[model samples]
Target: MIASNSRAELMQSGLNLIGQALSIFDSDLRLAVANRQYQAMFGLPDNLCLPGTYFEDTIRHMVLRGEYGPQDDPDEAVRIRVEQARTFQPHYLERQRPDGSWISVEGAPLSQGGWIAVYTDITETKRQETLLRARSEELSEQVLENAERLAAANRELAATITALQETKRVVTETQARTRQVTEMIPAHIAHMDRDYRYVFSNRQMPQVFPGTRPDIVGLTGDQVLGTTTFAVVRPYMDLALAGRHQVFEMTHEESGRRIRIALTPDRAGNGVYILSTDVTAEVEVREALTHASRRELAAKITSGLAHDFGNLLTVILGLQDRLTHAGLPLEAHADVQATLAAARRGVELLERIGQIAAPQGTALAPIRLQDLLRDVVEMAKATVGGSARLTLNADLPKERLMLDPGHVQDSLLNMILNARDAMGPKGGEITLSARAAAPWLELEIADTGPGFSPEALSRATEPFFSTKQGQGSGLGLAMVFDQAKLAGGTLRLSNREDGPGARARLRLPLRPVRPQMVLLAEDDSELRKMLRQMLIRLGHSVIEAASLAEAQGLADLPGLTVILSDLQLGDGLGSELATPSGPPLILMTALPPGDPLRDSATGPVLNKPFDAATLAAAFTQVTHD
Candidate 1:
């Protein structure tokens, strides 16, 4: 009996060890039978007869907390996890064991009614998980903030690009406008390479030289004006190409004008900048004013001298003629002839002096240019002598021009004679040409001889300034200038670009004239007939009247284009015609400059001795205005 009891005790001990081997939460909760671990772990009573401890007080207390019996309550939180039997997902909960140790309940549902649960002390794992989650949240917020900053930067970049584009557009437009303004300056501005090839030019260059075919950009003067112009300027260009600046004057043969040029070394040392200015008008004006004063002074001197000599010559000539007609002695015939010759020569000399001293006024009429040129050329050839070749080339249009014929002839002849004198005894060609020059007519005289030097060319037309010794009165060109001024024309002279020569150009205004009927209302018979004759000569049909009633009655006549009335009328006309039916009116008078009729005349006011061209120009100005 002792041996058997020992055996039973040992067997019991082994079973208890097997049951308590696992953690408390690792026990199987689905089984209804109480294993030794469950009974020992909960301190169950030793003599329990029932398989289910439903009536036990300890069981009741555990059931209230949903953890009672061999199998926990079905609806209890812990038992519910066992009933689900979902093994793929692990579930966990925290608890405090009675032993005062922190415990974690972890379980996975099994295929059976129970779950495999383990009670573990896992406080450290929970703490680490909490730390990792906090760190992740902070990192997520930081990422979101950085993304916002990056997006804002992109927007700023886009706005900056847009602003830059707008600024670029504005800069481009400003540069273009600046270029336009630079080109509009009235100078022959240009650039060129060291070889003298053109690089660029302003618009004024082509405008000044109308027929110039030179490509101002990328062409040498030799290429445009041929080797002639360049050959003449080779030294200056050579010096400029060697990096020296030069200021020089050149007479353009093609335009028959003078231009002053300034050349400077380009920035790269391989080019040049040329600035040329046309000083023709300014130079001409200065010369004109200077010569005009000298001519006036010389005229005063010559007129006084001629008047004194003329009286003496007139008395001598009259006495000589009487003596010759009286039939002096036969031996005195030779003496008589000698005296007559001396008197004739004296008279001719006086006539020459008077021609220079006379201050003649312009008397304009419709003059045929062809006839006028022919007559002037014939007279000039005779005066210039046979040694010098005189050629007159007239390209006159069929239209008749209203001009002062005498003044034009005298001016043209004077120019030819000047050319002749420049040729001297060597005898060069003198060419006088006339042709239609746009709104004007051009009279050009070119002479092939030694051209004027720089100083002489500058002051050629100045009064009392002459290159000739003793023979030159210096009044020929001065008188020509006066005639040009009187005719509303311009004169130009410069050295010929081709070789050595000089050319003089005169541009005269020309306009169209219309023939129509005119009603002349005048109180003076002499003035009426004089104007009537002049009007008839101008191809106008004139209806003359000595009184205002006769003029008003004649206004009914048809096809009248003009009405001429006297300012001081005897028939109560007084200068006002009551706004005549259909024609423009003109008032004629010998009134002073401040006369009311002169200022307030409705149409045009013609002063006494008013030339036809002036009247026509005034009429055109008034009607057009």
Candidate 2:
């Protein structure tokens, strides 16, 4: 609105600078614009000179004031001129007013509507022509006067046309720039008409909702957003159309992305403007933080109770021992034993609660999934015994996965043990399966047993909510849930739909040890600095070494993926830093293929003059012994 008003002010200022009187009428036969000279020349009141003043009213005022001339009936005279103006045709006329002043009016029709008229006082020019006719009878008086007036009108019309053309060009360029800026925004920006039909759109809708159309102009909200999504936002849309702005969020079911929408009503009551952005990542982070805070509070509460609870358990155990030594009766002895067992179990439960609620940093490393699975199966055998058969199905990628081996193995065992217990004495087949889910590693353990009850399904992950009668602690599922959360993954418990059984599935983020730590060993300062930059750009935390001795010292540090070294070190060959039980070694050299030194290098060697692509490719070969 500010920009529009500024432009209008600029145009008015320019029009007022013109010496001739000028006025422009819109298609509605109302004044759209008038210069200061126009008002002064006609002696029009402020109301008649303002935009939206009807042409008939101005004409009637002029007729009443005898600006044109006295008429037999002024009303009829005003009506005839008003009707003529409505035709909006090109015209030129010269007339003398009641004040004995002559003026020439030249009007040209506008393409959009109405006409623009420029009025020039030609009384002095007429006097010069009359004098010339009297002084020289030989001259053609009528021809000269007509030629002079025509030339003057043509000059003014040309200037007006040029100004209009410039204005049109500026408007066109401004509109194009606005559209480009809107399109560049990440979120969808669009405008709708009175009937909820799209009138303008920046074509960003498809990016927020994958299945929606990008070119949504001309389509109604319901048609563009589909029936389901349209229903979800219809209430907000109605509010905006009713002049109330709204901002809200909803999940786009088809894309499974969280979408935040903002609606602004048009001031003219025409329609609404909309902005929609995908905020799935933001929502996930918020939920994760909220859950973490709750867990922290739980840990504090559990930790505070531990000291008192430990003392109570010790007293109970001492009393049970006293009863045993007292030679209590056989029936009393059973009751004493039961009491001791309950107290011991309570102690164990308190310990488990603290462990599950406490926060722990994850230790991630590159691991061979197959080897880990083998180890888990071997360990689970002791828990399941000979009654149940353990089977493994892995469809994982060949690349070593990044994970905390201890936590993952512990979680897997927890699920497997739960499955074993669920199957009871009838011990059924338990399948441990693994697969890749892109950014995540998916693992599932399925057991052939009675499916989970509805109530168990809902509360299994909650601490101390066991289905087992008095024999279970119920912390197994809760521990698994925490491990997954710590790893920024998820765990789900569901009964198998195929048959009578239950399944525990886990998904952990697929990252290479949280951006692999790189130990760059190079003797040359300049070369080492260049290599470090490349490593950092590849999302690695780089630790630099200037010599083989420095490299060896750092190699022992944990979490290093590989030792990237120059073949020639200041003190010794980089090959000296290589060890059988250490991080993989990658050597860089400028030597040619035939050089003895290059051939002597056992580990992966990269030609020194290499780009990031070649440097990155050398990492794939770091699996070398």
Candidate 3:
């Protein structure tokens, strides 16, 4: 609106500067605009010159003042001229006023509305023409009138052409701006005909769905999006063509991305407008929130039961110890020992339940696939006895991945142990395999055993649901599931398609993390020493500090990659330590996972008693740089 007003003012100013008096009227014959010369030429008052003044009134005022010379009936003359103005015809004429002065009036109708008139005082030009005619009698009045009419027509034509050119330029600029805006938008904007053929596109198809062509203006939906993907949206497209709007989300298989598509019927009812955007990250965050809600509910449900169970085991342990000291027959004593052992197992079961119910935090880091597999194999060998054989088949790229190695190793080891037990005394082989599945690092652990029962296959990952009967705590696979979810990965248990064994596949996002130098701070001398050695083993040089003051002193030291401080230092809380302007700071604490001190730390926190691999993973995961 502001721009349009500015243009109108500029056009009016240009017209006012002209020597010819000019006035324009709307289709209703009311004055729309009048230049300074227009009002002055007629000696009109301000009210008569203002926009919306009736043209008929101006003509009547002129006739009453005898500007058009003596008329037989002044009212009749005003009526005739007013009627002619309404016809809006192009006209040129000269009239003599009571003052004996001649003025020429040339009026041309506007394409959109009423006519514009240019009034010029041509008294001098008329005298010149008369003199020329006298000198050459060949130039008659009829010939002079024809020349004046032609000149008027030519001027009107020029004005019309100028208006047309300006209008065209404005329209072109507007279209260019609209196209530029549509092209810059991140989402795909396109139009498709009723036949599902693309008619227009902003060339962003490939960005939303990888592997698809972007120059698809003339392509059919099937040709641009593949048969499978097109099939998913075909029904929606049909609905949109039927004048019904649709909005939904679907997974794009080609790129493994989630996409949101909105289809709206075109106003003409002959096509549909398409808008698609990548919503993969949004979907992931939503799923994570839902999973966290479920975990919180589970924790709430099990807290009271686990607490009561813990007290009962403690009492049982006390009674068993008393019975052991009371001394009965040898057989009775042995029975008492068995009772104590069973009670201890129950206590251990309760602890496992607590761990499962607790919230799990993930610390991801770069891990060499080969090194991880080697560590898992060595760990499994110690637990699997001589009867079982273990093997690793890896076809992974020579790259480091962002992952929580400790959790991954623990989950893998748990699966291996479960496999070992399933195979019984005459254990067979267990195979661990790794491969890159683009966007995901796929790892599988399969064992030679009686395949899972239907009930086991369905309930294995459920908390406290186990098939191992009395010997199992029923928390191994549950913990594994928690770990997988914490790391934004997935764990699946199924029977091997080709054999009599159960296979567990884990898929985690493929992200890389780089190693860095570390600063180890702990008040406990022994723990500090142990952490220092762990950092060195992980190929990171470490600087040791026994207090917050000591850590602050070394915090600014050059080449210090990261700060690994215990939450409770002798001088102050680790969280209170002023972070240096260098590497990231990570806090370590033995505090329960829900402790405020541990939770309130701004940076990453490693729950105390973490292993070398966990520490290394934490370093890589927390320090983004």
Model 1 worst lDDT window (10 residues): 19-28
Model 1 scores a TM of 0.54
Candidate 2 regions off by >4 Å? Answer: 1-157, 176-188, 192-244, 251-258, 268-271, 277-285, 317-341, 368-396, 409-437, 441-485, 489-507, 512-625
Alpha-carbon runs more than 4 Å astray in model 1? 1-163, 176-280, 296-358, 378-391, 415-431, 445-474, 490-506, 511-536, 539-586, 590-592, 608-625
All candidates' lDDT scores? 0.65, 0.81, 0.79
The lDDT-based order of candidates, best leading, equals 2, 3, 1
Give the deviation of candidate 1 from the true structure as CA RMSD.
Answer: 36.9
Best by TM-score: 1
Question: Largest lDDT belongs to which candidate?
Answer: 2
What lDDT score is found at residue 52 in candidate 3? 54
Question: In candidate 2, what are the lDDT values of residues 1-625, reduced to their tens digit?
Answer: 5686687688778878777788887666767678999999999998788655678999999989988777899989988998898888899999988987899898877765567788888787677666676766566676577568767866876786677555444534555577789889999998876677887688899999887888676678889988988999999999898899999998775554789999999765768889999998897687567656656766887879888989989999999989988988999999999999899888888877777677476666567788999999998998897888889999887766667788999899989998998999989999999988665688899999897899998788776689889688777887788788788787777899799999998988764323558889887799889889988766678999998888888888978878888899889999887889988888889899989989999978888698765665566446421
TM-score of each: 0.54, 0.47, 0.49
Q: What tens digits encode model 1's per-residue C-alpha lDDT throughout 1-625? A: 4584475456445434441211111122212223365454444465331222222333344455434334434345444534444233567777644543345545443332223333334344444445556776667765555556656855764574454344334434543565477578877677666667765565456554445663455467777556756676678777888889999877654554567778888655656777878776776676556656665676787767877777888888788778888877987877888988987876765564455455567676667898989888888878888789988888877766767788888788878888888989988899998887656788989999887778876676565567788677565676676677667677778888777788888877765455667888988899889888877776678889898878878776778667888877887653556464667778877888896656766667777778666665554444434
